[model samples]
Target: MSPSAVLHRQLHQAPTLALSGEGSYITLEDGRRILDATGGAAVSCLGHSNAEVRQAMIDQINQLSYCHTAYFSTKPFEELASLLIESTGEKMSKVYIVSSGSEAMEAAMKLSRQFYLEKANPEPQRTKFIARKQSYHGITIGSLSMGGHKFRRELFEPILLPNVSHVSPCNPYRNRKDGESNEEYIARLADELDAEFQRLGPETVCAFVAEPVVGAAMGCVPSVPGYFKAMKAICEKYGALFILDEVMSGMGRCGTLHAWEQEDVVPDMQTIGKGLGGGYAPIAGLLIGDKVIKTLEESTGSFRHGHTYQGHPVSCAAALAVQRVIQEENLVENVRAMGVLFEEELRKRLSDHPHVGDIRGKGLFWGIELVRDKTTKEPFDPNLQLAFKIQDKGLEAKYSISLYCGQGTADGIAGDHILLAPPYNTTREEIVRIVEVLQAVLEDVFGELKV
Candidate 1:
C-alpha cells in the first residue's frame, strides 16, 4: 500500500481497504471476502448495500441535498423525524436530527440543560450530569466529558467539562454477588446513584445519562433485570431528566426498535445512531419526550442548538428508507429469533472454553470476554492487546472474519471483549459461519500465542 494523506485511526498504518459490500460480507481490495460479523462498530444493520437506501439517497440528491436547517425544513427530515416519533408511539414527541451519534449525544446534553432552563421557573443551578463508569456515549468534547471510559478520557481529562460524575455500571458479571438477586443489585445501584445525586445536590443535577445496553466500553453488557426502572425512579424523585444513549444498541440491533422499550422505561431524552441509518448515510438524532417538549414549547419553542448539517436531506432520506426496510421485511422479528439461536450456540460452544470468561448481550448484539484465567476472572494485561490481536488475526485468509473488539471490560483500563453485531436480516447459515470462524480464529490466536 502506498502512503496516503488520509489520517487513519491508527497513525502508523492504513488498514485494509474495502472495495464493496453485499449481504453480510465486504469485498476487500486484495480480492478477499471478510464476513462482517461486527457491522463496522454495529453501524451496518441492512448490511453493506441495500438497493432501497441507495435509491432514496439518489432521489433526495435529485430533489435537494443541502438546505440550512436553520432556514428551512426538508421533506425527508420532517418525514424521518415523524417516523421516529411515531415508532415510539409518540412517547417521544419530537426528534432533532443530526449527522452522527456524537452530535446526537451533544444535542441531548444541551437539550437536557435547556429542558430545565425552559421550565416555568428556570433553575440555573441544575447543570450537572450523572453517567456510569465503564460507559461510552460519544467522542466529542461534551459527549466525552459525559462518558466514563477511563482510557478514552485520560488525555483530555484536564480540558474536558468537570460537571459530570459517575456511578458503578449495573454489570452483574463483574459487580453482582454470587447469590445476589436482581432486586438487591438494583436497589444497591439505585442507592449509589441517589448518593451521587445528593453529593452533587439533587436539585443541581440536570440529568442521569446511561446506555440501555452498554456499548464499546464494556462490550454489549446489558443491565440486570429492572435496573433501568429503578434508576429512572431515582432521577424522577430528584426532578432530574433521564437520558438513554442507545446509539449502538437501538434501532432493532437489540430486537426492539428502541432498546429502552425492553427496559420498560422511557427516557426524557434519548440519543440514537449506528443502526439507524444502517451505514447508508451519516445520521443520528435526539428524541425528546413529552415533558421536555412541553417545557420547551411553553418557553422558547425552539432548541438553542444548530449544526451546519443538522438535518441533511440525503442522510435523512437514506435513514428513512433503511428503517422502512427494517419494518417492511419484519427484520426486527428476525433479529429476535436469530439472536436466541446466536446466544445459545455461543454459550454452548464457549462456556467451557478456558479463556472465554463471559458471554453477554441481547438481540443481535453479543460479546465474548477473554480472560487470563476463567477461575479468577482475571483479564489479560492491556499491553497484550489480546482483543485487537484477535481482530487482526481474523482477517487472515483462513478465517476471513471481522469482529468488533473492545478493551477495558473489567475496569477502566483492563479486560477485553469482542462483539458480534451482524445484520438484523442475517440468516442462520451466516450466523453459523460467523460462530465457527470465530472459534477458528480463537484457536489460531491461542495457538500462535503458545498459551
Candidate 2:
C-alpha cells in the first residue's frame, strides 16, 4: 500500500474502503460484504441506507441547513428537542444539542457548575466530580478527564483536571466477592462512593457522573439490581447532581428509550448520543432536569456555554426522523424481543467455550468476556491482544463479520471482550448468523492460541 494523505488510526496500514452499506451489511472496495454486527460503535441503530432518514436530511437541506442558535432556531431543531423532552415525560425540561457525545458531556459538566452558581446560595467550592473506574464518557479533554478508563487516560494523566476522582464500577463479574449476595455487593459499592464524597468534602462536589450501563471501557456491564438507586441516594445526600452518560446504551439500545428508565432513578442531568441520530448525522445533547432549568431561569437567564453547531438544523432533522421511525415501527419492542433471542443464542453457543468467562448485557447490547482462567476470571494478557485478533479474524473471508472489541475490562489494562450491538430491526435469522459467525471467529482465534 502507498502512503496516504489522510491520517488514519493506524498510520502504517490503510483500512479497507467501504463502498456502500445496505441493511445490516457493508460492501467493501474489494467486493466483500461483511455483516455489521456492532453498528460502528453502536451509532447506526437504524442500519445503513435508511430511506426515511435520508429523505429527512434532503428535505432539511432543501429548506435551510444551518443557522446560528444565537440568532435563530430552525423547525427541525425545535421539533427534535420537543420530541426528546416528550419522550422523557417532560422530566428533562430543556435540551442542549451538540455534535458528539464528548461535546454533550462537556456541556453537562459546564451546566452542572453553572447550576450551582445560579443557586440562591451559590456553591463556588463545588467544583469537584466523581466518576467510576473503567467507564468511558468521551474523547475530548474535559469529558476525557471525567472518564476513568485507565488505558485511555494514562498518557494524559499529567494534564487532566485534578478535581475528578474515580471509584469502583458496578462490575459484578470481576469485583463482587465470592458468595456475596447482590444486595451486599451493592451496599459495599455505595459505601465506597459515600466515603469518596466525605473525603472530597461532600459540600465541594458538583456531580457524580457515570454510564447507566458501562459501555466500551468495561464492555456492556450492567450494574447489579438497585445499584443506580443506591448511587443516586448517596449523591442526593451530598447535594450533588447525578449525571448519567447514556451515549452508548440509551435511545432504545438497551430495550428502552432511556437506560435509566429500567434503573428506576432519574438523573439530574443526562447525556445521549450514538443511537440518537443513527449515524445519519452527527448529533448529541445534554438533557436538563426541571430543577436545573428553573435555577438557570431565575438567575442568569442564560447558559454560559455555546457551540457553533449546537443546534444544527440538518443534524436535528436526521435525529428527529430517526426518533420517529423508531416509534412508528415499534423498533424498541423489536430490540427487547431480539435481545432475548440474542442472549439465548449466545449462551447456547458460546457458554461452554473454554475461554469464555462472562456473558452479560441488556436489550440488543451484549458482551462476551474472554479469559485465560475462567475459574479465577483472569483476563488474557494485554500483550496478547486477543480481542483485536478475534475482530480481525472475523473480518476475514471465512467469517466476514465485524465485531466491536475492547480491552481493559478486568483492571483497566488487561481484560478483553467483544461487544455485539446489532441494529434494532435485526431479524431472527440475522441474530442467528451473528452468533454463528462470532462462535466461529472465537474458535479460530482461540485455536491459534492453542487454548
Candidate 3:
C-alpha cells in the first residue's frame, strides 16, 4: 500500500513506511535502517524490540484482550497497579490506568477537582488551574487547556476552557536574567505563582500543574534547583494541589522511576505515560496519593471519573512486563551512567558550534537549543523552522532523531530546540553514533542557513 493510503500529519507528502524493527533501529520499507533515536518522543525506553515484552503481549492476547472493569478485575491490572504503587512507597496507593497520556492527564485533572470537591472545599470558584508557560500536559481538550505552548494552543484559543493561568517556567537558560542567581530566579518564579494564586483568590485555585522536567514543549528542560520545592510550598500555603505531569519524563526516563523523586517533593497527584509501557502498548496512568484517595474514600466513596479502557487487561500486561524489564535489568542505572555520557558527548561535540546555544538535560533525556546568534542568544526566524531542518537532515543521515519543536524557549514564539531521549538501555557506542549523526546533521543544516 502507498503511504498516502493512511492519514498523514504533513499533508504535502506521503509518510515513510516501516517494514521491521530491531533493538534501537527501524528498517524502512525500502530496506534502509535508521537508528530509533529519541525513541519516538521518548516512549520506547526498552528500544524498538524486546523479546520479553513481545512474549508478554502474546501471552496476554491468548489469555484475554478485554474485560469490563466494573464487573471484574484482571490479574495484569491488579499486578501493574501494585507494582507502580510499591515503587513509590505508601505515599502513592492508587493507580488509574488509561490508554494514552492525554487520557491519563484528563483523569488526573478530574481526580484533583473531585478530591477538592469531596473535601468540601468545592467553593465552586476553585476551578482555576495554574500551569507554567512553555509547558505541555496533553492534547485532549482538558489537558490541552492546561498546556502553555503558544503554537499548540493558538488554534484552540477561541474554544479553550477558561481560568487556566500560566506563570514563567523555571528555565534558567532562557528565563533567568544574566545577573540572577539560581536561588533568586527560583524565588522570583515562586513569588509570581504566589501572586497569581493571590490574584485568583488562592481559595479559587484547584491545583498548580506542571511537568516536573519540562517535556516536549521546552525540550527536556529541567527546573532550576529549588524550583519545585518553592512551588510546592506555595501550593501548600494556597491550599491547592500540586500536580506533576510526568507523562513524558517519568517511569525511569530521567535516571529515576519518578521525575519528582529527584525534586525532593512528592506531588499530590501525578500523571505518567510514554515510558510507562515502554511503547510496548497503549498505556498510561495517574498515580494517586494517599491524601487525595482518602479524601474521596471518606467523602464521595468513589472517583467520578473512569474510562472503558481504564485498567485494560492486555495493556496492563504489557506495562507490567515493561516495568519488570526496567526493574530487573536495572535500566535506570544505565540511564544515569549513559545519560552523563550522552550529555558530556553533546557538550564536547556541539557546545561550541556557532548556532548551538545550550545543551542541558538529566538522565537519558536531553535537549540542544539552536540559535541564530550565540552571543545574543537569538533564535532563527520562525520561517526557517530550524528544528524541522535538523530533523530532516538527521533522517537523511539515517538517524531517526526527533526534534521537539517549540517556539518560546527564548521568547514566546521564536526559539528552536531539539530533544534527544534515546532508550534507557542504550550503549556507549550507540551514544557516540547518535552524537556523530547529530553533529553531522546540525553542521549540514546550520551551515546552509549560516546561523
Q: Candidate 1: lDDT of 282?
A: 89
RMSD score of candidate 1 (Å) = 1.0
Stretch of 10 with least lDDT, candidate 2: 1-10
Per-residue CA lDDT of model 2 for 122-160, tens digit only, reads 999999999988999999999999999999999999999
Model 1: lDDT to the true structure = 0.92
Error of 2 at 163 (Å): 0.6
**What range of 10 consecutive residues in model 3 has the weakest lDDT sum?**
397-406
Give candidate 1 misplaced runs (Cα > 4 Å).
none
lDDT of each: 0.92, 0.94, 0.86
Model 2 global lDDT (CA atoms, 0 to 1): 0.94
Candidate 3: segments with Cα more than 4 A from true spot: 1-3, 120-122, 397-408
For candidate 1, which ten residues in a row score worst on lDDT? 1-10
Which model is ahead, 2 or 3, in terms of lDDT? Answer: 2
TM-score of each: 0.99, 0.99, 0.97
Instruction: Pick the winner on lDDT between candidates 1 and 2.
Output: 2
Give per-residue CA lDDT, model 3, range 98-154, as digits (tens): 999999888887787777778855555678899978888889899889998888889
Candidate 1 per-residue C-alpha lDDT over 78-170 given as tens digits, one digit per residue, 9 for 90 to 100: 999999998999899989889899999999888888888889999989999999998999999999999999999999999999999999999
